[model samples]
Target: MKTQTAKEIADNLYTGVVSRFGCPRVLLSDRGQPFMSKIVKAMCEILQVTQHHTTSYHPNTNGTVERQNHTLAQSLRTYCNDTHDKWPSLIPGIMMAFRRSVCATTGFSPFYMLFGQEMKIPFDIALEPKDSLPQDTRVYIDQFLSNIKMSHKIALQNEAAQKEKDKVRHDQTARVRTFAIGDLVLLKVHKFPKGQSRKLCDKATGPYRIEEIGPNYTYGIRRISDHKKQASLVNATNLQPYIRPDPTRQRLSQEDQNIPPDPDSDSDSDPEVDQDDEVTPNVDVEATQQPTPTPQQTPDPATRYQIQKVLRGRRKHGRREMYIKWLDGSCTWEPDTCFDQEMSDFINSRWTKQGKRRKSYFN
Candidate 1:
């Protein structure tokens, strides 16, 4: 098939897939132009179908499609004529063979799973002769319905077992990652066109904050600078934790730590020197002796809110809301317009703690 435009894709998905199988609860696709288009988004919204995009550069997130493509290619290579142009003609036969064969993931043929019976190929016809006499239509119908129910029950059980086994194998190499709502993250980029120097180009983008998390590790993210805007969905593997810098705190200099103590200071005086000449050392006098601890400033009681977190943006609601988690274990949803500059800065500070450095986006 020729490459389709976004509108074409949206129409095909609705008519070809949805019409046949009904609208799915969730639709998963890569971040392709067709999938990410406005029309597709509208279609999903209207259908109430949650759309999920796989992490860029991580094809394994859409492994089912990839695996099927591989299988199809192998089959075509094995059966196609020398010219290879005849491959398209062989598709129906190849699909039938595949449907009639046992699937490794389900332990059952697609025909059996769907229709609750084996496909009546020519081989089956040759083995068993059909009875011409028709009788007891009601009893035959009841028995057929019962067999279908039993077959479906068996298929479901087999599918569950196969899934557990697959999960065990998958988990062996899978790394667990944790992310909080409103946490800034970097997303991997892998869709650059051909012939560009990848080493020189940026491999990832964003410091996007998590707006919402959906099913299957998919997250809705918006630019950290513009959290008020709508966000895009990205899978978990593409996102990595981003630690926003705190400008309020100052870092101690290593050069100052290595400097020798001042010899002229009264604190450097020997035991033979008079006690009256000895001076009280200042806490900031790092070059003299061990630095004294600075007294902690008491925070103002009225302004002291222990915990603060930004939940998400108010893109579509018209009224902006910032959901916060407090230290008292209470969660409150507050209007963003209510926050002053100080409160806004305080919430942004929670994006990263003091002195913690974040990893590079590409890595």
Candidate 2:
């Protein structure tokens, strides 16, 4: 516990669980270096314990452990001396108190659930009467077994009810988002260089293309510029659709257009041109000059690309966007305003046939 080295962590795990309770069937932990290192893996293999890790950068997968850690930290802060050097020695007392405390989800203390009886604290021993144990070992074993079974059943029911309440609370603000393979997205930056100000640095940094879709809202992404894949799969919560800027708007803004000078303005007239030099025999020249053919209408560059299909839709920052698959087999996300009335109608018809709600853009 003094250091987070792989050997130390593995030693502590073996001493803590194997010595106290025995080898567990499964070990769930975050993707920390100490937990994922070869030393820990070897230990788990030797103990025949299956190891599972939470998703990268996602702490909610191990929410129960995280919450307990938070509680432990709060307790340490409250009870530790001003120097905080003795905080490590107080962990055992805090842990015991926690195990005896009733959990809101299970509605029963962990001690009672595990041992089939409430723990006898100093206060209870002094103030409350203790019940006598059964004389026969068989009778006591049957009672303990029955109590354990009944307590487990009730605790499971309470846990289920609590989970439903939590789900409902979460669903009130949760939005469903899905991504397909080849979709472009921005990956959130979880770490910055040491001494760099996080507030000034960019929060998200990628125009990464999704290479593969995985279970549990995860995706394997690669950088678009270099095609370099990420080392670990990224969760959906840390990615946003990458909307490419319109090239037409940028081109028009950058290029200067020629404008004819005002004929009536004094600035247009050449004061040095003499009236005698202006010959009036320009009628023949004017008659010979045929009317210039009207310039052909140039097609809009924005509409040149043909859309093959509308793959999906999502709302980001209050703006609705559709994932468009072009005829050339390329894909990108476009806003609702980008589509003309005819294109909007076509998209709506396709979506309606697929049993999706109608988009309100054209209407």
| Candidate with maximal TM-score | 2
lDDT score at residue 78, model 2, on the 0-100 scale = 97
Quote the positional error of residue 130 for candidate 1 in Å. Answer: 5.6
* Clash pairs detected, candidate 2: none
Q: Per-residue alpha-carbon lDDT of model 2 for 1-363, expressed as tens digits?
A: 668999998988889889999999999998899998999999999999999888799898789999999999999999999998999899999999999999999989999999998998888889987668648889889999999999999999999999999998887556656899988899889999899999999999989999888878989999978889998788899998887876543433222343344454332365775646644556643443334222334443334546665667877555567877777889998876687754665566656533355654222
lDDT of 1 by residue, 134-240 (tens): 87989888877887888778778888998899888777556556677978888787777689888987877778888788777777788766555334556788878
| Cα-based lDDT at residue 145, candidate 2 | 95
Instruction: State the displacement of the C-alpha of residue 182, model 2, in Å, after optimal TM-score superposition.
Output: 0.5
Q: Candidate 1 regions off by >4 Å?
A: 6-63, 81-83, 130-136, 193-195, 225-230, 244-263, 266-363
